[model samples]
Target: MVVEKNVSLQRCNTFGIAARAQALVRVRSVADVQDVLADPRLARTPKFVLGGGSNIVLTGDVQALVLKVEIPGVRLVDETDKAWIVEAGAGESWHGLVAWTLQQGWPGLENLALIPGTVGAAPVQNIGAYGVELQDRFHSLDGIDLLTGEAFTLDAAQCAFGYRDSVFKHRAPEAQHGAPRGFGLAGRALITHVRLLLPKAWRPELGYLDLERKRAEASVEHPSAQQIFEWVCQVRRAKLPDPAVVGNAGSFFKNPTVSPEQCQDIIARDPKVVHYPLPDGTIKLAAGWLIDACGWKGKSVGKAGVYDRQALVLVNRGTPQASVSGGEVMTLARAIQTSVYERFGIRLEPEPVVV
Candidate 1:
C-alpha cells in the first residue's frame, strides 16, 4: 500500500495528455484495495480507480489518490451443457481476452475484437462494435465497494446495461426529470474480476454492413468464429487509427438515439444521413456522419484534430514531448458538439470519462 507522490500520467492515458497524480497506488489484488481502505490516511481520502487508461481524459493533475488496477488472470471457470463460463482479472487487456476465448474454442466474443482498455472497463462503458455489445455476453462481476470496503458481485440485470452506459458510469440514485431512474455506482465500486457467459451454440453476427462486405469478399456463406474475429479486426483497422500510432480515444461520441418523428425531421433536412433502426422503434444516428456532414473531418483546434478517416475520433496532433492537453481535446469536442447540435438539433454525448 505504498503511496507514490507526483506520479507522471502522460503515458498512462491513451490521449497522451500531460498530467500527474498527486498520489498513486498500484492495486495488484483485492487485498491491496482492502489495505488502502484499512489505512488511516488513505481510508478517508477520495480515491480514483484507473484501469487501462484507454477510456478517460485527464483534464489536469488528479488531486485524488489514484488506484491503478493491475490485477491479471484468465481461466475457464465453469462449463454447462448450454454455455462456457470464463473469468478474467480486471487488468487483462480486453483484446487479449477476446483472442484467448476464441483460441479456447469460445465464439461469442469474436465480434468485440480489438477494443481498447482492460476487461474491467468493458462493462463500465458497455463496449460494443460490429453489431455486438458487452452486455450480450456478460455473466457477472466481482468488486469491492469503495465506501464500505466490502466485496460484492452483480449479475447482468443489476448492471443496468444500456448503450455505452452502465451503473458503473453513474452516481447514486437521484431525482431526474421527476423520476428515480438515475441509479448508479460511479465512484463507489472497483471491479476485480469479470465472468463471461459464452453459449455453446454460437452464431455469426454479420448484421453490420462492413462485416457483410468482408464475408462477400471472402466468398464464405457461413463464417467461423475465427473468421468473424479476423473480419472485425480488418474492418476496425481500416477505419480506426491504432491508439499506439495515433494518440486518440476510439469513439468520441455515442450514437444518439431519437424518436421516429425526430428521425423524420433529420431525414427531411438531409436525406443522405446515415442511420440505423434499432429493435425498438428508436433510430440511432451515426454521429461521425453528422460531424463529417458539418465539415469537421480533417480539421483541427489547437493540437486536437478530428481524424481524417473517421470523424468520430478526435486525436492529438502533437508529439509526446509536447502532447495535447486535456483542455484542448475538450475544447475541440465542445466545438464539434455545438456544431452538430446546431445543424441536427441533437446533443452529442461524449463516450469517454473526462477526469
Candidate 2:
C-alpha cells in the first residue's frame, strides 16, 4: 500500500472540487485494504473509502485517510439458457461494466447505461435510471470488516436498499459484526466486490415516457437489448450534462414522494404539476419540473449553475478555484427545498450524499 501525504483531490472527484486529504491510500485489493488499516496512523484518524467519486461533494479539506479503491475485474460465474450470474470488483467503473455486459449480450443493465460511478458504489445508492435499479439485478456483495479484517458476504435483503439508499447509509458506524448502513462507510464495513444475476432472455423496458415516445417515433419494431442501451446513452447525453466537461453529479435532488392527498392539493392548485402515482397510492412528483417551475432552471450563483435542460442537475461552469463553496451549495439546495416547500408544501431532498 502506498500512502501519500496532503494529496489534492480536485481530479479524484467528478465535480472537480478543490479539496485536500490528510493522507491518501490506493487499495487495489481487499488484502491491500487490510494492510493499510493496520497502519498506526490510520488507527488514530478517521478514514473515508472512495470509489469513482462521482456522487460526493467535498465541502472542505477531509481530515481523514481517503482510500481510493482501484480493484478491477469482471467475470461470469454461472450461465444457462435463461440467465447468468456475474461478479465484478467494487472498483470497476460502472459504465465499463455495463458496456461489457452488453457486449456479452446480457440485458438487465441496459436501462442504467451511462450512469457515472464505480460498481462498488452502485448498491450503496441503489443507482437507477430509466426504469431499472441496481437492486433489481443484485445477487450479493463481499464486504470486508474494517476492524477484524474478515470478509463477509451480504445478500440483497441484507443490503436493505430503498430508493437511492441502503443499509450502508443509516446504520451506526460502531456496529462491528453487522452489515453496513449509510454510504458504505461507517461501521466496520468496506465493499470489496459485487455479484449480479442478469437475464438471458433480454427484452427492452420502455417504461420511461420519453424513451417510449422516441422508440415509437423511430418505428423500432423490436429493439434488441444492446440497441436499447444505446438509446439510453444517447438520451442521457442529450439530457444530462457530462461531468467531464461541465462537472456535475447528475440529479442533485431526488423526487420527493408524498401522500395522495397532498398530490391532489398540489394538482388542484396547478393542474400541470407532473406526478406519477405509486402502487401504494402515494405520489412521486417530478423534482425537475418543480425546480423549473420555481424559475431556478439555468440559474447560476458564482460558478455553479443549474443545468438549463435538466433542472435536477447542478453544474460547475468555472474552475474549482472560482467555484462556489460547500456552504453555497448547501444554501442553494436549501433555497430549492424552501421554494418547493412553499409552493407545494413538499420538501425536496438531495440525492447526492453531501459531506
Candidate 3:
C-alpha cells in the first residue's frame, strides 16, 4: 500500500501533456484496491483510475489519488459450439490482447486490432475500429466499486454501450445516453477484467471503404481474418500518427450523427460531404471531413496542432521538454469544434475525456 506523491505524468498520457499526480497508487490486483479502500486516509479521498492513458486529456495536474491499474492475465475461459469466451486483465494492452487472441486462433477481435489503451479502458469508451465495436463481442466484465470496494460483474446490456459511450463514462442518469440509463458508474467503479465472446464461425468485417479498397488492391474476394487484421493496421497506421513518435489520442472527435433533413441540408451545401447512413436512418458525418472542410488540417494553435493526414486528430507539436499543455490541446479542440459547427451546423463531440 505504498502511496507515491508528486509523480510525473508527462509520459503516462498519449497526448504527452505535461502534468503530475499529487498522489498515486499502483493497483496490481483486486486486493490492492481493497487495501486502498480500507486505508483510513485514502478511503474517502477522490480517486482517478488510470489505465494506459490512451483516451484522456489532462487539463492540469491530477488532484485526486491516481490508481494506476497494472493487473495482468489472459486465458480462454470457456468454449461452446457457437463461441470462444476469452478473459483478459484490464491492465493488458488492448492491441496486445487482440494480437494474442489471433495467435490463439480467435478471430472476432481482429477487426479491433491496433487500437491503443488498456483492456479495462476499452469498455469505458466502448472502443471501436473498422466496423466492430467492443459491445459486439463483449461477454461480461468484472469490476470493483471504488466507493464500497464491492466486486461485481456486468453483461453487455448492463454496460449501456452507445456510440463510443458506456455507463462508465457517465456521472449521472441524465448524462447517460444508453438504456437503463438511470445508473451511471463514472468514477464509482474500476474494471479488473474483461471477457470477450469471439464467435467460432468468424467472419471478416469489410464494410468500411478503406477495408473494401484494401480487398480490391489485394485482389482477394474473401479475405481471411488475419489478412483483414493486417489491412486494418495498415489503414490506421497510414492515417493515425503513432503516439510514441508524435503525441496524440487517436481520433480527437466523434463523427456527428445527423437527421435525414440535416444530412440533406449539408449535402445541398457541400455535395462532397462524407457521410454514412445508419440502420436507424440517421446519417453519420465524418468529423475529419468537416474539420478538413473548415481548413484545420495541418494547422496549429500554440503547441497543439491538427495532424496533416487526419484532421480529426489533435496532436502535441512540442517536444518532450516543452510539451503541449492540456489547456493548449483543449483550446485547439474548441477552436476546431467552433469552426466545424459554424460551417456545417453540426456540433462535433470530442472523443477523449478531458481530465
Candidate 4:
C-alpha cells in the first residue's frame, strides 16, 4: 500500500468542499489495512477512515492519516427459505448495491435508493430514506479495530440502531451511556464487510406522501420493488438538487422528535404544522417545513445557501474555484438551527459529520 502525501479532497465529498489530506492510503483489500497497521511509523499516526465522502463537512485540511476504503465485492452469502443474505465489501456504493440487489431479484432495499454514500458509511449513520432504515435490512458487519488491529463482528441489535445513529457514530465514553465499552466503533474501527438479510416475503413500504402521490399518478395501488425504486429516484430528483450538478449532502438536518405536549403547543399556535406520531408516542416534526416557515429557502449565507426546492438541503452556491468553505456552510447551518429553535422551541440536529 503506497501512502500519498497532500491529497486533494474536493472530488472526494458530495459537497465538493476543498480540503487536503496530509497523508492518504487506499485500502483495496484487507491486507492493505493490515499493512497499514503493521507499519511501525504509519501505525503510530491517528487515522481517519474515509468512505464515499458523501456525508461529511471538512472544516480544514485533515491532519490524521486518511485510510480510504476501496474493498469491492458483492455476492449471496446464503439463502434460506425465509430470506437472502447478501454480503458486500465496504467500498461498494450504497445506491449501486441497492440497484444490484433489485436486479438480482431481491425485492427489499428499494425505498433507500439514491442515498449517496458507501456501504461502510451506511451503518455509521444508520442511513434512512423514505420509510426504510439500514437497520431494518441489516444482518451483521465485520470491522477491524484501528488500534488493536483486531477484527470483530456485530449484529443489528448489537449496533444499537437509533434514528440516524449507531454505535459507529459515538465515541466509547459518550456511547457508553447504555451500550458496552467495545460497543462504540466511531473513530475506532474500519468496516470491511456488511451482510444484509432481505426477506423472501418483502412488502412494499409506501407510507410516504411522495410515494402515494406517485401511485396515484401512475394509477397503481401495489407497485413492484423496481417500480418503487424508480418512483423514489424520480421523487428525489425533483425534490433534491443533484449532488453532481449542485453540491449537497441530501437532508441537512434530522427531523426532530418532540413530546406530545410540545407538539400540542405547536399545533395550537399553528395548526398547519406538519407532524407525525411516532410508535413511541413522540411526534416527529417536518424540519423542512419549519425552515421554510422561518423563511430560509433559497437564502444564501456567504457561498452557502438553502435549496429553493427543499429547505432541508443546504447547497454550495459558488463555482468549484470559489466553492463554499466549511465555515460558511456551518455558519448557515447554525443560523438555520438558531432560527428554527427560536421560533419553534426545538433544536435541530445536523445530519452531516463536521470534520
Candidate 5:
C-alpha cells in the first residue's frame, strides 16, 4: 500500500473535479486493505472506498483516507447445468470484465456494456443500462468487515437490492457495524470480490427500443450475446460523452419513479412527457427530459454547465484560473430539482454519491 498526502483527485474522478484527498492509499490485494485498516493512524477517521471514481462527486477536499482498491483477477468458480458461476476481483474495471465475459460468450452481462466503475461497485448501485441490471446476474459477494477484520459472504437476498439501492445504502442504523453501510462504506465492509451467474442459454433481451432498431438495421434475426454487447457499446458511444474529453459521470440523476396516476396527470398537462411503465405498474419518468424541458440543457454557471446533448450530465468547462466550485454544482442540481418538482410534483434524486 502506497500512502500519499495532499494528493490531487482531479484525475481520479470521472467528473475531473479539482479536489484533494488528505491521504490516498492504493491497495492491490485484500491483505493490503487489512494492513491499512489496522494502521492505528487511520482508525477513527472517515474512509472512502473508491473504485473507478465514476459515480461520485468530490464536493470538497476529502477529509478521509481514500482507499483505491486495485486488486485484479477473474476466474470461473462453478459450472452447472443452469449457469456458469464466475467471480471477479472488486478492482477489475467493469467494462473490461464485460468485454471479457462477452469474449467467453456469456449471456447475462451483454446489455451492461460501457458502464463505468469496478466490479465491486456494480452491486453497490445495482448498475443498470438499457433494460438490464447487475442484480439480474449477481450470485454472491465476499466483503471484509471493517471492525473485526472478519470476512463474510452476502448472497443475493442478503444484498437486498432495489432500484439503484441495496443493503449497502439502507442498512439499519443500529446494525451499522455488522451490516453494509451507506455506499457500502460503513464500518469496514469492503467488497473484495463479486460472483455472477451467467446463463448457458443466450436469451438476448431486446427490450430497449433503440437497441432493437439497431439490430433491425443489422438484419440480425437472432442476435448473440456478443453482437448485443457490441450494439450496446455502439449506442452508448453515440449517446454518452466520453469522460476523458468531457468531465461527467454519465446520468447525474436516476429516472424518478412515480405512481401511474401521477404519470397520467403529468402527461395530461404535457403529453410529450417521456415515461415507461414499470413491472410494478408504476411509471418511470425520464429525468433528462424533465431537466431539458425546463430549458436547462446547454446552460452554464461559471465553470460547471449542463451538457448540450444530455441535460442530466453536468460538465466542467472552466480553466485553471476559473475553477468550478462545489457550490456551482449544488446550485445547478437544486435548480433542476426545483424545476422538476414544480412542474411534475416529482423530486429528482441525484444518482451520483454527492459528498
Candidate 6:
C-alpha cells in the first residue's frame, strides 16, 4: 500500500468542492488496513474514512489521514428457499451492486436503483429510495476496528438501524473504559464487506407517488423488479442532476417526521402542506415543499445554490477552478435551515457529513 501527500479531493466528493487531503491512503484489502496500523508514525495519526464521497461536504483541507476505500468484489454467497444472500466488497459501487443482483435474478434491490455512493457508506446512512431502505435488504457486514485493529462482523440487529441512521454514524464512548448503550461504530470502524439478503418471493415496491404515476401511465397492473429499477433510474435522472455534470449531494436534508397532532396543526393553517403517514402513525413532511414554499429554490449564496429542479438538493454553481467552498455550502445550508425553521417551526437536518 502506498500513502500519498497533499492529494486534491475536489473530484473525490460529489459536490466537486475544492479541498485536499494532507495524507491519503487507498485501502484495497485487510492487509492494507493492517499495514496502516503497523506503521508507527502513520498509525498514530488521526484518520478519516472516505467511500464514494456522495454524502459529504468538504469545508477545508482534510488534516486527518484519509483512507479512500477502493476494495472490489460482487458475488452470491448463498441461496435458500427464503432468500438469496449476496456479498460485495465495501468499495463496490452501490448502484452497480443493485444492478448486479437483478442480473443474477435477485429482485429485492431494484427499488433503490441509481442512488450514489459506495456499499460501505450505504449502511452508515441506511440509504433509502423509492419506498426501499438499505436496512430492508441488509444481511450482515464485516468491519475492522480502527484503534484496536480487530476485525468483527455484525448482523442487522446489531446495526441499530433507524431512519437514515445506523450505529456506524454514532461515536462509540471513549475507549473500552465504557462503551455506550448503543454500539456506536462512527469513527472507530471501517466496513470491509457487506452481505444482502434478497427475498425469493418478489413483490413490487410502488408506494411512492412517482412510481404510481409511472405505473398508471404505462397501464401496467404488476411490475417486475427490473421494471421498477428502470423506472427509478428514469425518475431520478429527471429529478436529480448527475453529479459528474452538475456537482451536488442528492438530498440536502432528511424529510422531517412529526406527530400526527403537529401535522394537523400545520394542515389547519395551510391545507397545501404535503405529508405522508408512516406505518408508525407519525407524519413525514415534504422538506422540499417547505423549502420551495420559503423561496430557496434557485437561490445562491456564494456559488453554493439550492437546486432549482429539486429544492432538497444543494449544488455547486461555480466553475471547476472556482468551485464552492465548504464554508459557503454550510452557510447556504444554515440559512435554509433558519428560514425553514422560522416559516414552519421545523429545523431541517442536513444529510451530508460536513468535514
lDDT (tens digit, per residue) of candidate 4 on 207-292? 99999999999999789999999999999899999899999888999999999999999999889999988999999999999999
Residue 246, model 1, lDDT: 92
Q: Which predicted model would earn the best TM-score?
A: 6
Q: Give the least accurate 10-residue stretch of model 2, judged by summed lDDT.
A: 179-188
Error of 2 at 235 (Å): 1.0
CA RMSD per model (angstroms): 2.5, 2.6, 2.8, 2.3, 2.4, 1.4
**TM, every model:** 0.97, 0.94, 0.97, 0.97, 0.94, 0.98
Q: Clashing pairs in model 1?
A: none
lDDT of each residue in 183-234, candidate 3, tens digit only: 7899889999999999998888989999999999999999988899899999
Cα RMSD (Å) between model 2 and the true structure?
2.6
Clash pairs for candidate 5? 146-188
Model 1, stretches more than 4 Å misplaced? Answer: 173-183
In candidate 2, stretches whose alpha carbon ends up further than 4 angstroms from where it belongs are 173-187
The predicted structure with the larger lDDT, 1 or 2, is 1
Tens-digit per-residue lDDT, 1-355, candidate 2: 8889999888887877778888899889988887876778675466788888888888898877788888899999888787889999999999999999889877789899999999999988999988889999999999887766678899999888899998877745435776434344344577999999997666778878978877887899888788788889989999998888888878899988999888888889889999988788889999999999999999887767789999999878777677556566667778888988898787888987776
- Candidate 5: residue 75 lDDT (0-100): 87
Clashes of 6: 0
Cα lDDT of model 6 by residue, 1-355, tens digit: 7999999999899999999999999999989999999999888789999999999999999999999998899989999999999999999999999999989888999889999999999999999997899999999999998888999999999999999999988886665767454468888799999999999988999999999999999999999888899999999999999999999999989999999999998899879999999999999999999999999999999999989899999999998999999999999999999998998899999999999
- In candidate 4, what residue range of length 10 has the lowest lDDT sum? 174-183
**How would you encode candidate 5's per-residue C-alpha lDDT over 23-60 as one tens digit per residue?**
99887898887887688887666778888889988789
> Which window of ten consecutive residues has the lowest lDDT sum in model 5?
178-187
Error of 1 at 330 (Å): 0.6
Q: What is the C-alpha lDDT of each candidate?
A: 0.94, 0.84, 0.93, 0.94, 0.85, 0.93
